[model samples]
Target chain A: MARVFMKGTEAIAEAAVRTGCRFFAGYPITPQNEIPEYFSRRLPEVGGVFVQGESEVASVSMVYGAASGGTRSMTSSSSPGISLKSEGISYCAAARIPMVYVNVSRGGPGVGSIQPAQMDYLQATKASGNGGFRMRVFAPASVQEAVDMTYKAFDVADQYRRPVLILIDGVVGTMMEPVELPPMKSDEEVAAMKEAKKAWTLTGHKLDYAHRAWIQPGNWSTKVMQSDSEEDAALYKSWQKEAEAEEFMLDDAEVVLTGYGISARIGKSAVKILRAEGIKAGLIRAKTVYPFPYEAYDHINYKKVKGILDIEMSIPALFVEDVQVAVKDRAPISTCLCSGGNIMTREAVLTAARKIMEAK
Target chain B: MELIYSRTKTIQEDKVSGFCPGCMHGTVMKLIGEVIDELGIIEKTACVLGIGCCGLQMDYMAYDNATAPHGRACAVATGLKRTNPDTLVFTYQGDGDLASIGLAETMSAANRGENITVIFINNGIYGMTGGQMAPTTLVGMKASTAPFGRNAKDHGYPMHMCEILNQLTAPAYLVRTSCNNPQNVMKTKNAIKKAFKNQLEGKGFSMVEIVTSCPTNWGLDPLKCLDYIEEKMLPEYPLGVIRDR
Candidate 1:
């Protein structure tokens, strides 16, 4: 397909539609309104359904319902709205319903700001809701990356029968960039995808108790709950192999910078500037934040690496905890922090990297 | 041997009733099953059950069913019915699940005129979590949360779901019936059948609120609970259809 200029939120919606998503339910929130707006217009044209739910709580629950019937369903919201959606998201995770949701993240901690920030890293990867359920959290840095991740997220969700998260900052959500859209799935292909789930989906049963579909998030018996927990633990452990990261010039660098989403985009530019200034700097960007790309840290040459710098648009840096776990104290770590909707700049990352290199 | 009366095939043959004795959930569930059997929608019908005692229906019904998070059954039904318009969808919710926590969802779905049926059981108090106060608990009704009786000054007044929903223009059918006696039981069944029939006819947002007895929660015997529904519950929640548009 030819490249078309599109906003991040609209592109993500279109990608979901192309991937055979036929149901969408969402509430309007800042930096993410384009998603539901685009769906409200585009879905009907493709014989799909779109509902602007009464609240975030209702929206995510609607997604959960649509997904239970084996339909490709989705919902999107910003930070505060995402908090309201946590209840339904937790239920979907518990019920093992396959759905996709996007967090066009703005500032947080109680309606903090409407501008872009990377403050939802911990919420996206760690405690998304009450239960300790893990999902494949995708952090896309640009419009094209967002489109591609949104396209593939549905298949991954169906393969595991779990929810997938697309975590992007407000800048990427509102920014326009040329993206090559994927081919739209044919109606027959969509039907075939749903047919693949007929074995377990809640389509309908002819009053046959053995084959009837039941979607329950909780087990009444303690024994059953314990067994389900054990199974989920093994499932989460299996995700370690799916961990992914982008290693940029990390073969032999003195200072290694790490981040995800837009922060890493800025950090990459900073690495180039630092290299031009006779500094051996490199960048490690996490594509899947849930797995945290721990193995990517091993590629850093600890003998030659003087320090590691964490760049993020969050105060009291949240993502650094994972970075610390990955690096395992091989070298000293520092942070370049921004918050309250402040966007990270290349100069700030450059300054932080330079200080880390000059420290020793 | 001649066949006289048999149970609806919608109820699983091996599953025993999990509802509390004297509780009317079983009666309502049976009526729902009978309606589905009569309509012959067993192959295409799906039930979205709310949390609490109403959620126990998942184990007994031999059809597609999903349990929504507490107070989200109406929203879930809206999603299911909208996406699969050909599928028969309904929500089974209790008073606390429908009138209290999920009032917003219920009202929104009803206001939007979503073509779905709602089977609401208004049993005055919360059953599964013990006799706690519910939004439909009558004035002077004693509950675990309202030990001093539900004072209108503090706990407000009991909510009439059918009356509240009738105020909305989108609802096609809104009725309140009970199973306190044999006649009322038949009336309740008829009301339920009408609600489901309305959905099948593409009429939007039909609801049948059943004013039922919760003997265990009411701290009364099964027989006395029936009298209680007649004297205490029926006065607050009158029977008959409020709207048939």
Candidate 2:
């Protein structure tokens, strides 16, 4: 597997196409624009369909429709555009239609800025839409991770018959890096992906009303709705076992720092600098945000640990809330946060860790 | 025993389209069923349902169908048709859903010349909700939202979908017909068959705009609603072929 240098957005698009995704529908937005642009040219070359939808609302609806037709489908956008797609994504969740989408996040509350930010942590992990539906959200720290996670997302989506989201930030979405791309799916395999899911997908098959796929129990039946909700709850609980986190330099540490996505990348570098200074610092980065990977906190050497610092690129520190819950107040937590297009800095994490250590 | 007529096997048994008693949605659904049977494409046809009164067709129609979010049937149909090129894909939408909220998707899909069929059901008001004003609501028509009547200046003008679509070069067929009477019903069915046939031939974008009535919302009996459609709706949305290429 020879590594090739590619932009994060382009690699993500190519990786998805290689993973049996043949239907691409998206609306252009900053930080994630290269994704749709690459698909526009690449998908047509592979006997696939690419639609630059009229709006984010229509783009996700197109994904829902394509997925319903049993095709491996996907969509991508930035924070603001994903906000518009929330409704259709929820429809996929309720229907248990397997599909993939990506949110290359930018600073936002309302189109706040187009620069790098992790402000969408809560939106992507918690309440995605009007319906209380949960999606498996993967946060990748580098361009290579972006490519790998995107390639793996489709399989997971189909396995669970649910939507999966690749949560990245502007830096990782646009930066170029050497990534070993996955093998492309041949035409036969693409068709087979659809054929395999035909038992439930709406592929012009004979009408099977009594056993058809639905979003919310068709024709308004309260009993069916309740049963469907219970089923979804069980599926959500099962994801706890799939949660993953990467632990770095944790043994014999006096202070630890935690982050994810691009924030985690910055925090890792900060830990190395602190260790060189003999500060005994370590890092724990969550790869799956929704399942949260609370077990990772148990690795902390509590007797030697002074306190943990939660750092990110968003103000009001949304990701920190989950960090607090995961740590369960075992250690006092301090926050180092920024927002509105400010990048999370390694210096900031190191400074915060020093403050926590000096306080002890 | 002698058989005069028989319903098509494509439609599910006793799956009466939960439409209002006088609504023409069921009759139109039956006509579509007949067309599917006539063309022998029932095994490869998919319907995309838009929200509104017409959205109910998803439940009763026997052929495979997916309900799109409100106002996005055309986009959904576009994706489905492109992904499964051999399959017959069509969208069933209402006035408010297609003309107002989904105007962008409808126009873009048609302009792109997507190989899909669209069945637009215009009944002047939003029938699913309490009689609210729609994009096709007639001038001086009183609606729950437009209590003082839809004045041209204040409420803008009623949207003529077929007329607007006719201007686009991509559509192989764009026609508006009625189902208020037996004679008009036959004409509407012919238009539907034409639209479907065009899709089978790989023609780009075909639409059959049927001007039906919402008696439940129109505050009239089913009989008078027919007359209202004939007298009021027809004049505003004159029934005829707007385009064919």
Candidate 3:
């Protein structure tokens, strides 16, 4: 496949379609509007359905419904919109419905800035909804990576019978880059995929009470709830092996910089500049934030590394908490942060690195 | 001996009704089961059940069903119906679920002319949550939340879901019926059947708003609740089709 220049959100939408996603329900939000817009135009071409729901709440609920019917379904929103969708997302998780959703994140605590920001790190990975359920959270730094992750997310979602989150910032969502699109799944393949879910999916049941399909988000019986939670705990624990991060030039480095999504992309540039200036700097960019690549931090040479600098566009620095858990006092950690949609600058990252170096 | 009537296979044979005495949900569920059986859609029918007393039917319903989040049954049905058009989809919702918390979803789905049926139970009070005031709770009707009776000054008048949905341009059918008496119960069943038939014909959005009673919540015996429906509920929500097309 030839690489073609495409915006991040558009490429993600096209990738989902090629991956056999036939149903999408979403409400419009900033920095991510191109996602639904692209799906609206492209889905019909492939016999897929696109619905702009009345609100984010309804949109996620719609995806839950569609996915329960054995369709590859998805929804997308930004920070506040994702907050509105948490309840439905939790329902999907509880019901063990396989679906995908994207969050083109922006600054937020309330209705925050519309520009690109990495303010939803904790929300996406830790507290997506009422239940303490975990989702495989993917943070893509470029359009090509976004395409690849979005394409593979459906398989992972189906395999785990859970929702997957593609977490990108406004920068990655709106930026344009050349991406190699995957081959579109044939209609037969799509139908077969749905057919594979017949055992669990709700396509209606004959008077076969023993094999009836019932999609309940909650169990009314205490015994069933307890057993389900125990099973879920084991499922979440098994994800430790799936934790992934891009460890760049960490060997013999003095300062290690870390972040995810656009902030990490900027941090990588700062690492290169610091290395050119004879400062042994490296980068650890998390690809999956959930099972937060703690093992990658363990591989760092604590004897040589002076400190770690956490780079993010969130002023309060939500991502640093995970970095702290990963590093675990092996090296002193510092942060370079901004908020309210202000993009993280490579200069700020370098300055922070230099300050960390000077402190020792 | 030839059998005149028996339980529909759509209802689980062994499961006993969980509904309170004088509550009309069991009767309505039986009517729906009969409709499903008569239409021969038992194998391809999927129901989205709302929260509140409506959700209790999940255990008794033998057909495929999804228990939607509170007030989200219509939205869920929209997704299910759109993605699997061959499958028959409907939402079973209560007054608080459809008219209050889920009003946006119900109205939006209806407005979009989604080819799905909605079975709205307007029982005037919230049954599952211990008789709280519902959007359809009649003015001057006492509730747990509105102890002084739903005064017009404080609490608004009862909402007529059929009339409200009839104002929309897309709904194919909107009817209000009740299950207070044998005659009215038969009428409610006919209306439900019509609503389901409309969905099968691809006629967009049909809703049968059944004006029912919650005897436990209404502080009345089952017999008196029937009288209340005839004397009070009917005057506010008249039985008959509000829209056919």
List candidate 1 segments past 4 Å from native.
none
- Please give the range of 10 consecutive residues that has the lowest summed lDDT in model 3 chain A: A199-208
Query: Model 1, residue A277: what's the lDDT?
Result: 97
- Work out the TM-score per prediction: 0.99, 0.98, 0.99
Best of the candidates, DockQ: 3
Order of candidates by DockQ, top first? 3, 1, 2
lDDT of 2 by residue, A149-206 (tens): 9999999999999999999999999899999999988888888878898766666665
Question: Which parts of model 3 are misplaced by more than 4 Å?
Answer: none
lDDT of 1 at B92: 94
Cα displacement (angstroms), candidate 2, residue A204, comes to 1.8
Regions more than 4 Å wrong, model 2: A207-219
Chain A TM-score by candidate, in order: 0.99, 0.97, 0.99
Q: Write the per-residue lDDT of candidate 1 for residues B58-166, one digit (tens) a residue.
A: 8878889999999999999988888778788999999999999999999999999999999999988999999899999999999999998999999999998889888
Candidate that beats the other on lDDT, 2 or 3, i.e. the better one? 3
Candidates in order have lDDT scores of 0.92, 0.89, 0.93
- Residue B33's lDDT in candidate 3: 94
DockQ (C-alpha based) per candidate is: 0.84, 0.62, 0.90
Q: Candidate 1 local accuracy as lDDT?
A: 0.92
